[model samples]
Target: MTIDSFTKLYERAVDLQRLMSPFITGHLVVEFLLRKLIQIYDVSLTQHADDLKHARLISLNHNISTITDAQKDALVGINKIRNKFAHRITHEPTLADLKTLFIKCKDAFSDFTDGIEQGLSEIDGAASVDQLEEWEIHELFIQIAYDLHHVYHNRGGDIEEF
Candidate 1:
């Protein structure tokens, strides 16, 4: 196994982050992670895509023992946001949306929220739902990439960095 495959997925996520709406980008991040989990866990891919498409399902998979509880909760939160954007064309996440998402997984995400606030403090220090959403998506992507790399390395996968 090699990190090249994982790098490609991460690059796709970065590309999506640049060109797509937050909803699309966030959804893709979760989707990519789920697909990678399927590979890492050697889960059968012949099942209905919907059965394996959920981030929560990936998190709950017994073979995915590399991630922490907080990471699992974060994935679920991201999935919730993605689902909201997916099911409603008119849905634009507001401050209320952030609050709702955060509350759903408060114990797992409070530190993450604090970190976003700290990062924002270096800028204008004003907090907006849009800003929070953007930061959360960014952080989620980073975390997913990190966890994927960790799994790959632990499995004796080699990375060729150029």
Candidate 2:
């Protein structure tokens, strides 16, 4: 990846560090990575229509089989969560909403989620989804974004396979 991409991601991530809503901010970070990945396949989209919506952005990544099914579900769930927050005023994510989407990631991708849980536990005792704080939800978003980024960066190997 170019240093400019690295700088942009780092800047957005730093913004996420001070976020009040991790789901929203994490969505933004993940969206940026998605946009970059799309650019890899259709660089013209960057010049023509850069601000594609969440679902559209994700649809572009649909055929990237390198991304696991659980990863795809997490991206869709993240988009759904962002939409719910966007349309409502003063909305706090209920535990059930968090459970279906955020908790599902923990089950589907235990390896990364375990690392996330450990870090969150150290800071805020957020070891499990049972006691999920808003910040912990944000960490889940960060984890999903990093996994997409891993796929994006390593796609050269996948290209030939496709």
Candidate 3:
């Protein structure tokens, strides 16, 4: 894929993260990551949630080493949440729901939170920078998605119609 297309995908994920429900945003971000992985590894994949699940297994089998264990766990959590929203008529993930998921996958998010905090401190904000609150799960997820995108691009992944 062209850099433009990659960037557009990342931006769309970020936009969804900012404005959509947590489940929807998480699903979109995970989907974006899966698609990027397919391109990165040149794997034949259909765009399905099951394919996304299998991508992780295939990556491990191929030794592609795409995501950390914590990231894999986080993706699983995201998928569960997305599934709940999709299958249940009254299911809507709240901020608290997302926060719990983040806590459950805290290890995966440590580097991202640290980087965001450092970046925030470097900027001149109205108030002194402190820890990111629980309500910032959306921002946290956005940064994580951005970092994942950079990882793929930095590792020389590109899209070319074949």
Candidate 4:
């Protein structure tokens, strides 16, 4: 693995680790090693179109594709929730919304992380060898970075980078 690729993964892992830091502080068990998983997604999405929304569209629109469509949907859903949480000034997220957000967060977390692990193994453990398609990698990184930012921001952490 090249230093660049390893650095990418390491950075993403640290972001994810920081994102989960809040849950850890709340006495809740955040068990998944999502940092590594997010890096894999970031690396794999390099060859697609520049528009991440389009890539997410392709993943969500296709039913028979290798990646699970529902997972992609959940990721998008979580993104929406995060946006609301981050942007809405006067609106307070209801308990139901938070509950749903938590569920989608965990679900998307499982789907993406599992996909990353399976994808890494399938490619002969070459995730850190070379970058994959651009859009795929971008989508993965954005999702991970968003989650990391969302979680920590909610708990009042000052994370300067993704």
Best by lDDT: 2
Better of 1 and 4 by TM-score: 1
Worst 10 contiguous positions by lDDT, candidate 4: 27-36
Best by TM-score: 2
3 versus 4: better TM-score goes to: 3
- Candidate 4 matches the true fold with a TM-score of 0.31
Q: Please list the C-alpha lDDT of all candidates, in the order they appear.
A: 0.51, 0.61, 0.53, 0.38
Error of 4 at 9 (Å): 34
In model 3, the number of clashes is 2
Off by over 4 Å in 1: 1-20, 43-51, 60-63, 96-124, 130-136, 160-162
List the candidate 4 regions with Cα displacement exceeding 4 Å: 1-48, 54-66, 105-162
Error of 1 at 46 (Å): 7.6
lDDT of 3 by residue, 64-99 (tens): 566776677766777677676556533545545555
Better of 1 and 2 by TM-score: 2
In lDDT terms, how accurate is model 4?
0.38
What's the lDDT for residue 147 in model 1? 56
- Model 2 stretches with alpha carbons more than 4 Å out: 1-20, 64-66, 107-132, 156-162
